[model samples]
Target: MSFPDNTVLQSFPATLNHRNATIFTANRTDSSAQQAIEDLIDARLQLRDRVSAPLKGMENDLFAKSQPLDSLRPKLRVTFGRAKRDGAFDWPVEEVINTLGAQKRGAPVAGLYGFGYRKSALGLIQEFFIFTEMLDGHLNGLTWLKRERNIQNLIHVSFNLLHALHSKDIVHMDFWANNVMIDPQQPTRAKAIDLENCFLTPTDHLTEVLAFQFGFYYRREIFRFVIEHDYDRLVFEELGKYDGIDRRRFDEIYALSKHENISRRARREIFHKGTVVTG
Candidate 1:
């Protein structure tokens, strides 16, 4: 199927599951949108042939036979399949569409290149494909940061992204260290990924949505530590043992995260100020 005019293709290598659907990336000579779709179909065919006669325990290894694709620019290709029972894609198609919307709206996210789907003999949708920019040379926030400056920079970047999303009334339901990726070359800039679970709501619901996310998400412990002591102690006294981020500024982050009105102007202030570390 021909994709929209905005579609562009590059190459990357990765294999992972999206719900029950299989997603993988491969290289292709053609950069056009239609050619990209055909490349994905060819990759799927190759995957099927390999899986048809699996080696011992190979079925259990999802990353088996994964190989890197060659390209000057890297792009991600995701494929989604339908479940037999529900006759629907294993994952929510709207999630991918919403992510594209987020990217277009200036949210810190991977750029969406294009998306298309395959249909069955009866014209029913059988599969879905999405193409996006590959975040090359990026490491998640959980990875090691060799310098105190790098750590401080990541914190600033993360909160700035959070505020950006909140300003659009979008709640990153799974905001955490691993969801934010940074490149050493651009230490202070980060991009958020895994936005499939993000939630959109009215501006008035922003604080409540943020509260819910905090209560149930991975970084709830950060707030707990902050309440018991303070953002400073939580950073310098506790987490400093791990990352050595002591003396690094976090006041703006603390104020934004702990503010009663989380989506208020404070977030805008921090975002507009372009939080950066000095000294």
Candidate 2:
């Protein structure tokens, strides 16, 4: 339970999961790699510091509580966790999300902090966790699903992850950068965390996740987030390169996202029940 130890951490793939992720093995002696990480760390710290500047800039707390993400119902094989420099540690939040009474939440894959889980050790079935540090020589970052062309392969995989989550009726309140994850070297490594505000549907409910027939406005948002961020890269030049689709699907989804009428369709799809998308 000692955080799988350095040997284990090093041996394990840079990442896991099929949603969207890129895990790279650590470098023992790479100065540039170390510097790039330092740069990212600096940027992250700067962003955190900016939180205090809200009045003149923005006034928000730097860190909040970490929450449990999800886990297997029948089997304990799955789990998830959310954390930053610090986490609020809300246990009952899960109850609210799981209560299908106007709210449906995922049971959890589970959330384990690098240090917390290791200390409080939850039963023998759990794996010891350590802070997912952006170590000097080791950097594990989320591949912006629709943000970069080099990681373009993640589009289909991430879409499927989103589909699977929606199928269970879990509403991901925050689906932006910090919420999304990816593995650059491995295929299908996308992840969405920070379930503090998530609403759940039902684990057995196929309607929540993507059914072939269900019309989730997800198709549209995926296009929006993508085009707005990484669409211009040379790799994304053609839509066909994606999981193999015609160019029109791209334009089609993008167009739908701009529709003011039904523009809120995606939001309503996951949030409110009676909310209607005008289009």
Candidate 3:
């Protein structure tokens, strides 16, 4: 679909609300942003209790915050619940865009709208942007892995996602299958929807593996990739863990993964090396 010249498809309001929560682009009446907000509201209204697993307070809080939907957005796509270890009040959602920039590779993040606090109800809400076209939820975890028999495609897309973040000097502390979103049309490409625990640094590696889920050994190998800057090793090692992947498939995927990483690193090196001229 065509958009207007002044339209801000991946943009949000630059300020917070009176409650100090992040304000969404409710004021942008002419843009597609408003319609996106309406869609989120519609999705929330239609959400059933049985489907919301793990996220306990989802339905009640969504309904409570629904009245002022224009001024609010969900911290999670559909789920609702506080992190047992981390406090919801102090999440760094609003500042992430400024630190990390919007797009990684070709995929744009759902913009961070700010934070929302409502009395004794939903203490603090980390408001991030959402596009309905990308679907309201991410793939269901190992269930998806079982269904997705083409393991090579999953490895390439998932690893490319890691490479994209590491190239930016950003480490996604909580990397899990559920946090990732894959477009139905282009299943090969994946984008991260959750970014609350992301850390930015000039350092090449992240040593400690604190909080993680799904693929315990595989996740550690990803951390190893970040620490060692070994793209080939990551591809081979991760592929080795899955017995279903054949040698031919492994070689092909590994070659693509290696090529992409080398090209990415080369571009980064040149970009950071700056202008150098002989005297």
Candidate number of the best lDDT = 1
Q: Report clash pairs, candidate 1.
A: none
The alpha-carbon RMSD values of the candidates against the true structure, listed in the order shown, are 13.6, 14.9, 14.0
lDDT of 2 by residue, 1-279 (tens): 222123433443344211121222322314443343233333432232211111111112111122232333311321233222222212322322222222213322222211222111344212111223221111122334434544345545544545556556565544433344554554354555445455554333222212211132233344444453453342234322234333444344333433433432334342444233435
State in Å the error of residue 273, model 1: 32
Model 3 over residues 1-279: C-alpha lDDT tens digits?
111211332444443333323333323333343333344434544442212121122321121122222333333321143222222221333123322343433443443332222221454343332222233444533434556754445556665666566556555545555555566556656666555455454333121111111223244334333333443455556444333434553454333332233232222222234211111
TM-score of 3: 0.43
In candidate 2, stretches whose alpha carbon ends up further than 4 angstroms from where it belongs are 1-148, 167-169, 176-178, 202-274, 277-279
Q: Score each candidate by Cα lDDT.
A: 0.44, 0.33, 0.37
Model 1 C-alpha lDDT per residue in residues 1-279, reported as the tens digit of each score: 211212322222334333333343443223343343444455653342221111122222211122222221111122223222322212224345456657757877766544444434443434555555556667776573434334445555666666667666566756766677787787566777766556454333333334333323224333432343433442333232223222223434443444333332233222334332211
Which residue pairs collide, candidate 3? 21-115, 22-114, 22-115
Candidate 3 wrongly placed segments (more than 4 Å): 1-22, 26-89, 92-108, 113-115, 119-143, 204-279
lDDT score, candidate 1, position 53: 17
